[model samples]
Target: MIEIKNLSKAYKKRKVLHHIDATISNPGIYAVLGPNGSGKTTLMKICMGLVLPDEGDVYIYRESVRASIQYRRMVSYLPQIARFPDNLKVKELLQLTEHLRGKAQRKEMLMELLDLDPYMDQLFRNLSGGTQQKVNLVTCLMYDVPLYLLDEPTAALDPVTQIRLKEFIQHERERGKMVVLTTHVPHLVQAIADEIFFLLYGDIYFHGSVEQLIGAYQANDVEEAIARLLMYEQEKVKI
Candidate 1:
């Protein structure tokens, strides 16, 4: 469903992604993992056409995203940080999104699933961080798209909400949709990810299944292996 070719991006003197080449053509959840500044968010933004790549091209459904953006119709993205107009109420914002998308989305269903109906009339800024995140999730997941790119979907979510998000992701995969996400939550990744891309220093350094990752790093679990990989990358940079 998606292909990235020779993708590279930099800001002034710093590079955020280097020749990132990957494909997400099949249905499954792929997790992108790394320490701070690994370019996970930048990678997703480039795919979404929100950020222009300094080099290379991203193709969605065989159409080049850099040249045309019609392919974005197949994607649903949940950004790491959501910024909404403070004056608008939660329900109003959702209505606006549905109007703009011109689709009969499952907004009401998502609101109920997230338990956001209670805050429907509250202004965006009035919601607490976790509540606001839930609102964002409702809007983002309301539509059924072929590809989903979620950056830290579990962030600011309560434990129960986190589990709900995981179940939702799994549901999408079962429906034959592609799900790509970046997260620091190890247990979440362990539960849902069919594949893992360990990004380090702006590049994908490791790609494998969860069990393969633990075996490769000789760590007792997913979190420990992730820690080991990050440390290995940092040390490699210094040498």
Candidate 2:
């Protein structure tokens, strides 16, 4: 469904992504894992056409991102930070998003699931961080699109809401939609990700299933596996 070919990006002297190549051909949750500055967000932004690649191209359903923007209509994106107008009410933000995008088929359902009705009349800036994140989620997930790009989706979410979001993501996968998310939470990745793309310093360090990741690192769990990978790199640097 998506193809990233020899994708590279740099900002002045520092490179954020390097000749990255990956393909998503099936419908499932794919986790893009990495430490800070590992180019996780950069990759997603490039895919969304929000940022242009320094080299190479991304294709969605065979259409190059550099070619046209019509392919974005097939994607639903949740940015890491919620930056809506401060004065707008929750309801207004939803209305505005729907106005910009087409009508959201699952807006009402997601609002109920996220318990957003109580906050509908509240100003976006007045809402709590978690509430704002919930609102962000509703705006993104309400669209019934073929692909979802979520960046740090559970950042400020409560445990209950996180569980609900995971369930919703699973449901989307069950319905044959591709969900790509970048998260630092190991357990969340273990629970929902069918495939993992582990990024380290602008390169894909590992790409496999959760089981394969742990097994490759000879670790019992995701957390330990990640630690081991970092330790391995550290040891390499000292060599």
Candidate 3:
């Protein structure tokens, strides 16, 4: 479980995250949904211990992330965008990452599961965007980490590849790994997310099961549900 308590961040005295407190107990896919600049990325970075928060603590499995290298070892993260060495081949990149992670050999299970065989010899810069995403994802999942944090992981994939990734997420969840991701694609969220965090204006406006959102909003789909919530919020501010 991941617990965030009174978390906040500011840049040059301009606040981004407020005193946000959230608990992620459900060990399945949890989608963090938000528009641009809603502080989703900042929250993820803080949870991953990449960014320091001005106030509050992040706890993973009852351990403070900031104080324990062991806690960091149990987490896998795939950023929204990544840049690799332009001169490295796919194999070399994977090799380097695995070595750094202390995994001398690739996890054959993960490689086969993600269908990573096809691009082993391709240059990092030459692969298509979607393929690059696959590589990025593979690099993270290769480690037997308990927590997975992915940001907009399906942004550039085709329908087939997207479907494949959805399956992969489910598989990971079933293995008792906590999968948290941020996404703007409602369809993808509806398909895989057991819980949704609807963030607005740097706050978590709603956090509930996907079915709860659909029922509470009286919407037939996730998109409509999201639209209803946003519209209601807008009207509340107008009054």
Candidate 4:
């Protein structure tokens, strides 16, 4: 479970997020949709305790994330971009991560699922962009955290890999894990999202079930519905 209350963040004097409140509980996939610079990544960072909120609180599993930083151990965060030590080999990286995680079975399972074996001997910097993304995904999934926060997880993934990743997400959700993802692609969101959050100007302008979004926008698909909502927000701003 994750609880965010009156959460806000800023750099210098410019505020990216305002007072916001949201709660996500149990095993379900939550999709967060927002325009560029709407603070979607910022929110995820705060939830993961990587960034402190300028105001308000974040509760993970009923405890303040700030008070129990170890709670982060139970979370797997896939940031917008992942950076790895240029010289480390895939196998070495996984080995180090597993050592740090105290040798968890989940790490091995994720490596197998991502087909990372082929690249085991290759240096991190030598891998292709898509392969690097695959490695990052595998790393995060390895923790077997009950909560996952993924940002633009499919950016460099191929179609088949993307489908496989989605299937894995679904499997985790079925196992009663919480997954929160931020993506520009609405089709993927439609396929896996049970709940959707539409963000504008650092605020959640709308949050509801997927069915409600479809009905409210009267759209044939999730992508169209999100487009309509974005346009509606733009029009409101203009007025």
User: Which number leads on lDDT?
Assistant: 2
TM-score of each: 0.97, 0.98, 0.92, 0.95
lDDT by residue (1-239, candidate 3, tens digit) is 89988888887767878888899986799999977888888888888888999989889888876776677787888998877885798899988987788783346765675677888998989988888887887888778777889998888877877887889789889988899999889988898898998878767789998899999899999999999998998899999
Candidate 1: tens digits of C-alpha lDDT, residues 138-226: 87899888888999999999998888889888998999999999999998888999999988777888989999999999999899998
- Measured with C-alpha atoms, the lDDT of residue 171 in candidate 2 is 95
Could you report the Cα RMSD, in angstroms, for every candidate shown? 1.1, 0.7, 1.9, 1.4
Tens digits of per-residue lDDT for model 4, 182-228:
99988998899999988888788889987889889999888888889
Best by TM-score: 2
Which scores higher on TM-score, 2 or 3?
Answer: 2
Candidate 3 displacement at residue 97 in angstroms = 0.3
List candidate 1 segments past 4 Å from native: 237-239
- State the lDDT of candidate 2 residue by residue for 64-167, as single tens digits: 99998989999989999888998999999999998999799999999999999999999999999999999999999998999999999999999999999999
TM-score of 3: 0.92
- Whose lDDT is higher: candidate 3's or candidate 4's? 4
Lowest summed lDDT across 10 adjacent residues in model 3 is found at: 104-113
lDDT score, candidate 3, position 62: 84
lDDT of 2 at 119: 92
Per-residue lDDT, model 2, residue 115, is: 91
Clashes of 3: 0
Which has the better lDDT: candidate 1, or candidate 4?
Answer: 1
Worst 10 residues of 2 by lDDT: 197-206
